[model samples]
Target: MIPFRFLHAADLHLDSRFAGLSQLPQAIRSYLRESTFAALGRLVGVAIEEKVDFVVISGDVYDVSDASLQGQLRFYEALKELGAHGIHVYLIHGNHDPLDGPRLQMELPEHVTVFGAGEPGQAVACRRSDSREVAVISGISYPTAKVTENTALLFNRKPGSTLFHIALLHGNVDGDLQHETYSPCSRKDLIGRGFDYWALGHIHKRSILHENPVIVYPGNIQGRSVKETGPKGCYVVEVNEEGYAQLRFRELDSVRWQVREIPIEGLADEAEWTRAVEQAVEDIREELPQLMSVVRFRLTGRGNVHRILSEKGAAADLLTELQRRETVRAERSEYAGLVWTEGFSVETGLSIDRERLLQEDSFLGEMLRLSRHSGQSAEGLDDLLSAALKPLMENRELRRLLAGAGEEEKLGWLTSAAELGITLLSGVEDEGGAAGPMFSNGAAAARHEREAEE
Candidate 1:
């Protein structure tokens, strides 16, 4: 049996948006953005420490088409460290970093082999002095962003019997909903190619689609945003003489993005809210060690606390205070950093009587009717209205606007306007009295906008 170990990783979206991390102090923001590079260094350090045979980067080394030159250079330096340690590196460009790019001009280390965009693929014969020639490493590159052709067909030609065949690709094996369907292919197509191992990329979550041929996605080396959550890292695979394969996950992420949902049903006061938030933070900090974390705490369920949380500025202030305490704790640790962050958010508002709103055959009822039947243009109006009303509703500004007006006057022109706004935007209803759909999709979008503004 060939005795060898290798690191398989993908989707290092370097220099990407630090959306939630932006709330962090400048020092913390710098650390978070640079964490990907740190994770890359750690990956190399692991390879050197374990004395792995080679390292494979499936794809998406960068985040955007026009990435920073400094970022590219940093990547080159990290890969060069592995090369200096006599570890061979194999790489292929994924959708994010297609082969046809100016950054590819940089000179790479001798031990590193980057698969270019060409006919079929490139193969490297792996031979050791004592043992038999063990494996044939082949890979294809994404010449452009859209690769609809079946690239797996190129690997139909198998390696000699003396060696195992491994193919590294940066395309979607199939149209997985969790990811964008780019460079699509089926499991059978890959299996039929007769390759021993298929190292795939593009999707941010790690998964083993097929074990027989050992098709794997090592996920991203680091989580870039809230969408890509939890532990991010690479895979270490071992193949024995019998062609049986074993895979192990190695977390190389330097920062983590975590989501925690805490129900507000029983929270009676500020003290309860503080206690709940503190407990949640402690739990998350314990779970993730020695890394910066961005946490989104969602308060759910029915309770009196919901009213307090929904009351304009109270919710925002409470969240801010919670984050402040968490940051202090993290700073004292002197190892891991904590950035409790909130972004485009929603808290269930006071529920209203839907039946009563529908019973009144007035302008409010008519507006709801029109909203339900509206087409795309109406949908656009809804979106616009949602953008306008979310802040007003959340801040209780709408309630203030109607203050002092008699019932008839309140339900007159302004009520019609508010109902029209709700119809156009699909927001909380304006029950002929007070109370509506507490929160709506428009509220969510407005929250997002506010977060962005911050």
Candidate 2:
């Protein structure tokens, strides 16, 4: 069998703006602005370095509003680089870049072939070393932004001319609740086609629906928001003599996004808390030492630091100090990589000695016991606990917060009643203690019980 390799990528979303951010340092902002283009350049670098036979981009090459002249020129330049290396390029437009969408009118390089929107098309790629057909790639683009048809069903089976076949698609297969159901289809439809591999796009998370025939989603090359966290890149695929394919994920993202929850338990003072946060940033930098990172941190767990952190504007102050340190680190560092906190949130409670509180033998102790008992066995405490929490849940402000919260999230908030109780009783003037008045009505004991049920 002739050895052949290809790079599979999707959802470039070039020139797309990063959401949920503002007032960032100029250096970080500059990096974020060029991250998508840099990721594409890295993909082209991979194609040249691996000397792959071809590259397949599933869809969404650019944002709907960003088909500017510069965007088109940058995309063309990348393709020209690949064509110069004798690597073939195959692509299909997705919902964001439909056939009729606004775009810069330009011609791609001779080696680049884009499938049609109205119908599926085939492109046979031949190995440069052997001059023989190595793979048959079939694909179709979206004609409009909303295509509810089962587009995968339109894909024909592998032709008799090539042993290795790949289906490049941009649709929601088996539906993901987080995304729209465009060109939706089931896994059965793809498996039935007997294609060697399915290159998928649109859902921004990498997934492998099957291994027997190698179906894959390479995800987006760059993450543009907090929701899109961790490493984002593409897959390099190689076929063996027996027709078995091996896939390996490559890191092409110039900037990475991460959300970390750090427990503040056992931390006694603000200094300790800051040290812990610094350590987390160091750990993240070590993990992705080559790429710059934008991180959001949530301080959790119960401790004395909770009181300090719960003060008004405490989180914002911490973020300011963190950003200052980030600037200093960047200036002092000799390396190219840098890391900074995008935002900080405090979700901690007051440290409460639950065992000691339980042994009080007073009304509060009895309430705590009842809360624990209700959780263990819903036998008798469900109604009692619900009644106790009713006033809090009915509060105009608290109700608003819990209005969209699911049962699990409600349970989590309810279970933190002990810490809230301790803070309120101490009159710490803390944010978490603000909920203390509602719990003072003896209804707070239901927190533990609610947790057990959850």
Give the top-scoring candidate (lDDT). Answer: 2
RMSD of 1: 10.4
| C-alpha RMSD for every candidate | 10.4, 7.3
Q: In terms of TM-score, how similar is model 2 to the real structure?
A: 0.81
Candidate 1: TM-score? 0.76
Residue 213 in candidate 1, Cα distance off native in Å: 0.9
Worst 10 residues of 1 by lDDT: 433-442
Q: Report the lDDT tens digits of candidate 1 across residue range 317-436.
A: 766776677556655654374655653244444434444666567776666554444322534444544554566666564644433234344233333454434434444433333343
The superposed Cα distance between candidate 2 and the true structure at residue 210, in angstroms, equals 1.0
Candidate 2, 346: how far from true, in Å?
Answer: 1.9
lDDT of each: 0.68, 0.78
Clashing pairs in 1: 344-447, 344-448, 382-424, 382-425, 429-437
